[model samples]
Target chain A: MKRIDLDIRDGEFISLVGPSGCGKSTLLRIISGLEQQSGGSILLDGATVDRIRPRDRDLAMVFQSYALYPHLTVAENIAVPLVMRRLNTTERSLLGTLLPSAKAKRKEIAGEVGRVCDALSISMLKDRKPASLSGGQRQRVALARAMVRKPSAFLMDEPLSNLDAKMRVQARGEIAALHRQLGSTFIYVTHDQAEAMTMSDRIAVMMGGEILQVDTPDQIYQMPLDLRVAEFIGSPKINVLQAALTEGDVLSFTFADTANNRVQAAFRPEAARLAGIANAPLAGVIHHIENLGADLFVQVMTAGGNLVVVRCDPGGIRPAIGDKVGIVMDEARLHVFGTDNRRIEGSYRLEAPL
Target chain B: MTARSFVSSALRHTALLLIAAFALLPFAVMVSTSIKPADEIFSETLRWWPQKLAVIENYTEAFSAAPLMLYLMNGVVVTAAIFFLQVLVTLPAAYALAKLHFFGRRLAFGFVLFCLLIPYQAIAVPLFILLYYVGLLDSYSALVLPFTISVFGIFLMRQFFMGVPDDLVDAARMDGMSELSIVWRVMLPAAIPALTAFGVFSIVTHWNDYFWPLVAVSSDKYFTPPLGVMAFRNAEAGNDFGPLMAAATIIVAPLLCLFLLAQRRFIEGIAFTGIK
Candidate 1:
């Protein structure tokens, strides 16, 4: 009985991000009319698409596997959409027995193929079959195919998830550029936070078959609407330390019955600072350090049996393994989630990004 | 090569050759004995080669004994009818059985398998009586109707259709194609090998099927080639074995040619049909 209440304006580049099995893929399929949602209807540009066949829906989806028809060559695969679009029922009737339409459908298709291939920089791979193309090349062909249709919207589901890390980064920029170039509504789905962060103008973070938050990427990262969104939208997996918001707005944390546990202290690793204070605000043994030359993510196990990751500079000094490090995560950057697993009321007071 | 290895290789080849000769002996004897003059057949000694090739003479006489050209036309028409009819019916049924889900679907498919078990002979008399009542007896309808729905064709197509990725079909669906269009354009094109294999099977089965033609067709003009081949052994050729073997050779040659033409397709199709 759930509903997808989408009011995304045309030409918006929206990324649907979530963990696997969160139904982001199902949502994409339903929108494209490939599948039916048992209850609610899907509308395309103010028109109901519930009864429309997927081809007539004017929606093109680039599947996660690229779903390039393995039996078809690259040109033929890309040409499928155009063929379905232009060829009338008569012209396609059993070997074109019905008089062939003398229209310029072929010329139009050729022009479309040329334009899209150039945009995707894949003109050289026009006739090659999908098996001959590398992964990156296949991705571009998928993009070109989707773009060639000139559909009202493009539906892409985790298109970059199949590429290697470096290629994914390059492909990310290209997809974002393509979205802008077309100026069409793009509903994309991905499970990677980095992908969501780098490419999307706005992201709809879905979890457990529901959208937890839908907002611009900066708003999602800085002012998450849900506790799950806060944890899901960031890298180094945001640390969730159990604590309480006590009187006078002071947040304190502890782990035992004899100790007082209060407001939940959630913060990104880079927000925390390290100092040599004797009675440290937060202290732990330096357990695992991932040094990326510029910045280090030092994973530390606190005395309370909670793991707090702190990002520190590796400039001219390296903290020895197992050595105790005193750190204070900036209070202003901390986000608090309530017992209900919702963001604590009035906890996020940061400026909302435009 | 080592002595043992060489001996084993030779033994394997010798075994294969023997098996080949064993299988081919009747055919060789039939062709050889067919052209021996009527007087020399059943003589004290057997000859492996004909004194003269009398194939055209034998064929012309075989035609004269029966309207063989009419029978040949009938065989082509019936086999063609069966083959094309099978392709049409079984493809969509196979697509439905392999892909779609509806109420009582499993039961319906089980019934198709059950239909496979009901032998043609069990229903042939009943079918004839039905055809007689319906004014279809002695007509092509008798031969075509009862065999229109082929369980073997359906089974082969369904198995081959199973290996095609669900996503590919789903993609076609998403592309706005109806279920039937998907079957014709996507599924069938992808199943060319299977269709060819089943085409061969269907043609051979119907071509060699003399019993049904014998019962369904009382008209000599409607007799298929295999049924007409039966005319050679009438008492006129008693101990005149030459003509009978020539007819047998003709009967078997078409099957050999068909097998050679579709051998690779048959092997690959059957092997890959079970992929799903």
Candidate 2:
């Protein structure tokens, strides 16, 4: 990773969001001490933990595959960390069963396992092996295993990626609730922006091994510092148009194949409206209409041959395919980018048509 | 069942029965010859049923003529020792070859593959000389030590361990298990089926081994079952066919009983190893 620096606060839920191969999961692994970073050191609670082993790091990890031991029952799987931590070598042996202290320690361990299972609502599955559990159940078991220790923090690598769509939504809510109940630091990594947006206290947008921006989900969606961040954070991505800034602070954006005239501005689909051709700054033929029950998104093919999607209210006037219409940009909602792809600072009104 | 399926099943059963009979013909002849009296054996008119049964006498003579019990004990000791040592040596080696990354891992595995290509018998004379130099000949060490580091065992276990997911091992490490503990506690349990297959292969080969024991040990005390059988044939009653067959039966009985007891597991292990 190149010049990526992030600070996760105490009891905070932070998510690393990016496309695959963006080093999000790699950064998480480095934090967990599962993978070592070549150049940097990791500090946990003001102590350098980079050289520490994974077991000694006082951190728990939930893997994407939910790597539960298949031979162990759910309860035993959860008890593994406890057993390793609480018992000495001799106490973990078969002969240790005959020792009174060992028995007492085992009972105590069992009680903790029971409590974690009960908290996760998997108390009934304690006796079953991981192979027999469903994907969602296995995920809970993996969570229970990580939670049994009450570690300093939890590092999860795409923990919900394997679940079905419906299960993923429910699991997301459960994990958020779990974080609240545990009140522990969580560093979650995922390629899904929606997951990051909905669950994180703050989202760190990473790209090409660098963290582009770190802010609350609202701030990221509304005020992206870079163009790639703007495109990656939103669905039906923020529309980007090639444009030039002329004198009088005027911006002129032109579509392809139209060198004669330049239209001024770029805006998100929700920031544009269908208007009458005479007054609209840009004209296009409606290519497709998508009715999503509550809102409709209309795709327009402009005269300069660029496709622009406009989000319109379902109750309002809807245009059919092949209908010629003009697009009116919402002046206040328009986002202007300079040639360097940086957000332009000043705002100016459009010129009135003659 | 349908009429056509019934005919096919009948044909399959008939073919299976013929094959089974063909396989069992030798054993049946050995048992028949073992129980037959001297007069019935000499008057050989290909009669399977003996005119007079001499079960007790032939079996007792078979035991008494040679120290058969001692030889069986020796076979048990040597086979068990070899199997235990092989697993002790092979499991860790296989785990390392399958999982651990090091500078010379590929080269080490290449050497293991090269070792597999060389037949053990081809090296027996050199092995015997080595044992003699080490003063281990005519002892249990000579019988068991040469077979301890089994290349076949390592290869079989390496194949099985390769199928074990790396996630599980990493999980174990995260759970605070040392690498050695992971091999025994996690990998060993997971590789049980393959280990069982290798066990059968190892035990049967060592138990029935004749050429190695013949070359390695010269003393009667260290004689294995095959050598014991040889001693029985070299005795005065070597021409007595009934006791000879009885001795042969005794020598082969333990493995037969073992195979019968674990037939399902043995077959599953062998089949799993074959598919992989």
- Report the C-alpha lDDT of model 1 over B1-276, residue by residue, as the tens digit: 999999999999999999999998887878887777766666677777656666676666665655667767777888899888888899999999898877887888888888878989899999889988998878677777788899878888988888877777777776656788888878887888898888888888888998888889887667788877775465365545666666667777777898899999888887888733
- Specify the poorest-scoring 10-residue window by lDDT in model 2 chain A: A255-264
Q: How accurate is candidate 2 locally (lDDT)?
A: 0.87
**DockQ values of all predictions:** 0.52, 0.65
As a whole number from 0 to 100, the lDDT of residue A100 in candidate 2 is 89
Per-residue lDDT of model 2, residues B74-96, tens digit only: 99999999999999999999999
> TM-scores of the models, in the given order?
0.89, 0.91
Candidate 1, residues A1-354, lDDT tens digits: the string is 155676777888999999999999999988888777888878777888899778888888887878777767777778777877678777656656334362466567777888888877888988898889999999898887888778899999899888999999999998888888889989989999888888888899888888888898888987776778989988787888876544535566533445443455678888886656464566778788888888888888887788888888888477777888777766677788766667765533311111
Q: After superposition, how far is residue B36 of candidate 1 from its true place, in Å?
A: 4.1
Please give me the DockQ of candidate 1 compared with the native complex.
Answer: 0.52
Query: After best superposition, candidate 2 residue B181: deviation in angstroms?
Result: 1.3
lDDT of each: 0.79, 0.87
How far does residue A100 in candidate 2 sit from its true spot (Å)?
1.7
Best by lDDT: 2
